[model samples]
Target chain A: MATPLLDKVEDEAAASPYITVTLRIRRFNPEISDEARWEDFSIEIDPKERVLDALHKIKWDVDGSLTFRRSCAHGICGSDAMRINGKNRLACKTLIKDITSFDRKTGATKPITVEAIKGLTVLKDLVVDMEPFFQAYRDVMPFLVTTGNEPTRERLQSAEDRERFDDTTKCILCAACTSSCPVFWNDGQYFGPAAIVNAHRFIFDSRDEAGEQRLEILNDKDGVWRCRTTFNCTDACPRGIEVTKAIQEVKRALITRRF
Target chain B: MSADTTATGSTAAISPVESVSVFDVDHPAPLIEPPRKRTAKTPKATRGNFEMAAWLFMRLSGVVLVVLVIGHLLIQLVLDGGVARIGFAFVAGRWASPWWQTWDLLMLWLAMLHGGNGMRTIINDYAERANTRLWLKGLLYTATVFTILLGTLVIFTFDPNIR
Candidate 1:
């Protein structure tokens, strides 16, 4: 098995499709030192491969102590969200060629920077403490609530009503949008875009009867009012949730009391 | 063999019990505090519509201000011989009409409130400390109130002929 794998790797190397890429990772370990530092690793890899694959290569081959969080290796799980080249993106979704600036004349490429998402405490290297993000999510009451007897069948909803909140339902509870927000970076108390997006999902749902309660909860001082309409959350959302638009809708609902 | 067995028995006696657990259901590990945890010192949510009203007021006043401000600017700066024609006499002549008085009054109030609210929002966004925010807002409110009052008095009790 080892001989066959080595032969396949050699065959692939002969194609010369690989380019040298440098990954600059911001590392932090409290057990060693309190301050975080940048570490670089240069590897020869296919340009079409993901930044996550490069991280894996560095961890597996170069340094076994290199740490980061990743699961599923696909975009759907949202476990590998990190700041890639100063923008919040899923590491698995970001291709190496897209982030690394390639020079045609010299055949050189810029180093891809990977760091933990902002506005959250870094646990180790790329992993962040997600407790606060989840706290905000929980505070929004991101679920349907109803009074009176349960319906024998499902609570009926029209196609148009379902479409109203269709965009916000794609959230994967990733901190990309929240951590990208400038307001949240300064004041963590503010319920960030992800929470507001989740609230919008339930607030507009025809089956959710607790819309008023959730609205009241979000009407707090640290709620949607803090959003500066910076559009950063919209730009950072991995699911293309139109986070800012959903926030605006929530604000409108608060004002008009109409979905 | 007897001596070796005695040494082994003594070593086993020194070892701690394996059945005893450090943490159990009754005495568990302490929970880590959430970064943005709301403590007792944290103020309760106002649970008011003040922010919504402020947001809406910004838009509504903005639309009205566009018309009022543009009309005032055109009259003062561009129309009827431009800035050269504007003087004490021009102001008195404009204030003689109730329509102009109402326009000026509306413009003064709306502009002050709009700008003041914008400053309040900026203070809230940037000010990290609660005391800092309070003091800055106090100063802003004082300045805003003084200006509004002085402007209102000037508009309402205008003595055009005062030397």
Candidate 2:
């Protein structure tokens, strides 16, 4: 009995190779369930495994009907972004051990809480309707517009010119940065950060000829003025884009007419 | 699509490509949305640095307000005595000092403007109807102006020797 107790003590002291953590998941099924509810899952996982892998394990072994969008398990496809521990983040990007939850009583570690990103209508569990997000993106005309002339060759620009808009090009059309914004949470009409980031991509591109038209489009009341520079979008960006800075650049461009 | 094709006739460019311009066959066209409205009355892009100025103002005022508020609370509720020690005489004595008078005045002005601007943001965010936002902001401006004027007058023209 003494030897077994000593072994158990040493195992716990080592933090154990496989640690048990609780996943407090918000569940919703509009057709069946009248209101959303929280469900707890206990799984033993390595600290290095991503939250996406944990979600996969839960779906495969525990609950078959649980629904969420994911493709290209890497961070590139940008399909698995959701609210993790009360902030917008990519499931594939956030590791289980890297994030720790808060305890109300002990003020220490608690269960990992996962919820759907706010501002969009949640269809099933983790799935949110992305139509509104894509609408704002389309409003900015994200594609390069060059009515001047069909380039006999590709539109050529110096490396310096390419670097001007290089940062905004990293956006994978993921709405993580946009949904994390307090302004977006409050007002649906406000063009959120993702759209502005996309606009910045083209507005500063030296090869793009339709900067004036794009600027005019963004000059509406719900445009750049609505951004309060809260920096939540910057924090939530999975691609490491400086979202608030891009918005300020657009604001500066609108003011100075120079991009 | 490339320069190496100069040896071959540029047949791909001449041939009718898939109608991505008109309609994409693989993906359905995104539903057309009515454009966001713009008007000549609103502040145009030519209006330079107004929003930027407001953003800076908020940060500066916030820092100042923090100092003013903490000092005020310490004086009124902690230092000397407590809230029970405060009265009309206390207020009058404080106002008599030019330094205290200036501090109170600054606090009043900054708080009113910050609050009013914040309320304007709230109205912009929540008031669904345009007329509703206009009316709400109008009321907020009126109230802010009224309070600031009254407070400023009080600070400047306080009668320390009232019977």
* Residue pairs with backbone atoms closer than 3 Å in model 2 (clashes): none
lDDT of 2 by residue, B1-163 (tens): 0111111122121122333333233532343222222223534445344555565577789999999999999999998778889999999989989999999999999999988888887788777667888899999999999999999999998998877
Write model 2 residue lDDT over A28-82, tens digit each, in one string: 6554433456777666677688888878877766666668899998999999999
Q: Candidate 1, after superposition: displacement of residue B62 in Å?
A: 0.6
lDDT of 1 by residue, A1-259 (tens): 3456887888886887677877878876544444566777777888788989888887766666677888888898889999999999999999887888987888788778899998887877888888788888999998789889998997889999999999999999879999999888877788999999999999999889899898898888888888899999999988898999999888888888832
Please report the candidate that would top DockQ against the real structure.
Answer: 1
The lDDT of each candidate is: 0.83, 0.78
List DockQ, one per candidate, in order.
0.12, 0.04
Tell how far residue B88 is off in model 1, in angstroms: 1.5
Which number leads on lDDT?
Answer: 1
